[model samples]
Target: MPTKIEKDSYTGTDTTGHEWDGIKELNTPIPSWWVWVFVASIIFSIVYVILYPAIPLTDSATQGVLGWSQRDTLATELAVRDEGRADITASISEADAAIVEQDHTLRTFALRGGAAAFAENCAPCHGAGGGGRPGYPVLADDDWIWGGTLSAIQETIRVGIRSGHDDERYAEMPAFADMLPQGERIAIAHFVAGLTGKGDPAKAAAGAVPYQDNCASCHGEDGTAVEDTGAPSLNDAIWIYGSDTGSILKQISNPQHGVMPAWEGRLDPVTIKMLAIYVHNLGGGLQEDAGL
Candidate 1:
């Protein structure tokens, strides 16, 4: 049932003739200011729709009266940025990596450009900061399998390791499990682990004989590794596969090699140069005077 409308005596306001206990409900009116704000919002929305995209359709939104688009704005901005960078990019192309590093403008441009390219391409395997994973070598550290010079890093990026490219850098260690007995393999594993001073010395002593006889040719007599052979150093704390004796034993049994993609044909020459410079600046690159 509808409540009858009446005037309340205590307050000069109209009330609905409905009472809860002794209190009557007041017929409150909406604020005039609020009503006007709501009307203004509706008008603004109509104006916005008329000036910019608003209505959605099957394939695209309605092209508004202004004839402007977000895509066009982005393209214009990118064109301006590229035009500004034309001279610096050309300088990077002509100069060597070391020469670029000496120039403030060229080095700054290369570092920023290289970081973007690395995130898109190299971050999947090498990590965002080049920390490396189980099979990948750390780029931020002093240790390197092939070398850590700028030229070395750049060349590796160009041809890649075991990539099947015509000029690819390739190296492989024979799986000793196919040739050696289990006992000798375990001994070699122990010896290799002990090179980092983390293995059982008792087993390591017995393992040394087998290690020298079979593994020392490429891994070196002291387990320091032969970089030319791409054999990782056992003497260092940095281990690409694993540092533990168990992982070492597994590798001794059946080695697993990693392959890097050749970027020479995939990336532009300038991009490749920038990527090389970026990697070299990651706190581990050797100077020209520093021999491998």
Candidate 2:
């Protein structure tokens, strides 16, 4: 059933003991270098299996000879990084927030730390750059509901505004929908809108008497809101809720109050101080002596 092996007459090469359509396959041995390389690869694979975690078992992989793990290496790297920053962190922890600005190194460290903290904690409500969201007040503007000095900012961060914290800066506007007639509320809304040049002048004039009787106590007769009461100035164009007539009406009916969480117990004091500094430097912070 088998053909006898023989050397091909044309090429002088030995043929395998088989033939197909008068052609025979040449019996050529694999190269020694290639065979040795393939054998070496098998040996290397065996060594690797013994030296490193390879085979998967029921609960975990096999513990290799070295016992080294990626998680352990990462933990070691993190510990080294923490050690490097320990001195700066400790310096900030001990330094007074107000005096931190005097030291360039401390201030730089504080700004970096404060930025990271703000992103982690405050970015959800106040926005990445403190530009504020719809219901939240802008931190990068001259308008401030509470005082805006460094001390004031620090205090606000510590206690928060309208938060449940005992020390929170609290302010409340009566829901006029429950107190005043609908017509009077509308007129008051118009008047408030007119303060920023946005509503009917005649309606605003008609509403002046009602506004004087109801709003003048907290907001001055000239509509300049009293800072002590945390009332925003109506004379200015800046409106926390909005400046349009519809927005004014909604606020007059049922006022929306903003709340900030107390950071005193949550974040460290040095971090809070750093936050205050970062917020105050956002182009609209006030100086200690600056009037509200």
Clashes of 1: 0
Q: What is the lDDT of residue 69 in candidate 1?
A: 93
Q: Mind giving the per-residue lDDT tens digits that candidate 1 earns over 2-73? A: 376788777878987787776778987889999999999999999999999989999999888997899999
Clashing pairs for predicted structure model 2, backbone only:
none
lDDT of each: 0.88, 0.86
Model 2 worst lDDT run, 10 consecutive residues: 93-102
Residue-level lDDT of model 2, residues 1-292, one tens digit each, is 4588998788887888788888678888889999999999999999998998889999999978989788999999999998998998788778777778668998888788888888899989989988888878788899877888888899999998888899989999899999999989889888988877879988888789999999988887878987779888888867778888789889888999888889989998888989998888887889889967
- RMSD to true structure for each model, in Å: 3.3, 3.1
Error of 2 at 240 (Å): 2.5
Per-model TM against the reference: 0.83, 0.85
Hey, what RMSD does candidate 2 come out at?
3.1
Number of the top-ranking candidate, with TM-score as the measure:
2
